[model samples]
Target: MESHILAISGGGFSVEEKAFIDEYLLKIPRKQEPLKIGFIATASNDAQGYIDEFYTAFKTEQPSHLTSKDFEALNIQEVVNALDIVYVGGGNTQYMLEIWQKTRFDIVLKNAYQNGVILAGISAGAMCWFETCYSENEEEYEEFKGLGILKGSLCPHYNDEQRRIAFDNWATTQKNNILYTLEDNENLHFKNEKVVAKIRT
Candidate 1:
């Protein structure tokens, strides 16, 4: 039985988002088993801290983290066999991708998702999951390839960036693009590969 995926920008879990998850579960065709979570936080030094924060925020619990350099050493088949959600945390995108590719973490993540494990992320976690990302260097713009989880490219911290004008211009030229400059606790939730709603609180 496959599950739905929800990706959010970091700050904290939105109350509305939690309610949305509950509603989402009611609509998933199959009756869900006990929800198991695989927390992926290659970006944060205190990855467990972030995970704990989420658990406390949402009042949900699960076991183990599908994280680390030796993540692939663990049998993916067995780990994902019982997982219903895989929450990836934000970090340096380039570094995360490097580690992901090096340890075949990306492959494991895709497998989990394909097997009905919901996928979610924040910041770099969110940016990398898209097909492409608008990378901000010292000056000028560069398009970087991403995980291809979602079709279009993503630009995080959009409105907040000093180069807002330039970034907006670049995004305008691209056919499939979306920019986000969320405050401390703003997020967009997508369903069926399209942004179904946004929560600002």
Candidate 2:
């Protein structure tokens, strides 16, 4: 039961990112229960209205065709093996990686987050779940390519204003991974893969 990821920061939604998704669902791990949520917004359907305002903040339960054009007619390995928490909203990262690789949904969302589910995303769906993404709409900054399920380089619409000068020019290039900058109710949690916590709204 290893699941936990939160990456918010889009055009809206932030009461401290809904109090960090209610303290990141009380840090999960409570008998896994019937918590089968999986709202991968396929990139801004108004992020399914911020996943229906996160069901008034936590205790998950989204599923009734929650946008991404209904996950472009689902079927990505049965929607990541009937998910357990996969929230990915935010908009237009090359049209949400062209409809999430035309419904391939990035190999069933990285094999349902390495067989434990629980993956989050925001702002261009947390910059395409990182692995490289700096497309500050041309004019110089650019680095595309993602869905590596986190491993560096994801600068969502941080501090707005057209991505605050491209996240301060990708925090001065010379990249080599690790570069998250999702302000507007900041967040950065990862479980089995590391990064325990860093939420700041």
Of the candidates shown, which would achieve the greatest lDDT relative to the real structure?
Answer: 2
Q: Residue 52, candidate 2: how far off, in angstroms? A: 30
Top TM-score hit? 1
Q: Which stretches of candidate 2 lie over 4 Å from their true place?
A: 1-7, 10-75, 87-92, 99-101, 104-119, 126-136, 140-158, 164-183, 186-200
Which residue pairs show backbone clashes in model 1?
none
Q: Can you write out model 2's per-residue Cα lDDT over 11-38, one digit (the tens) per residue?
A: 3333345454544644564545556665
Instruction: RMSD for all candidates, in order, please.
Output: 4.2, 14.8
Clashes of 2: 1
Task: Give the 10-residue window scoring lowest on summed lDDT in candidate 2.
Answer: 10-19
| lDDT at residue 11 of model 1 (Cα atoms) | 52
Each candidate structure's TM-score, on Cα atoms with residue i matched to residue i, is 0.73, 0.31
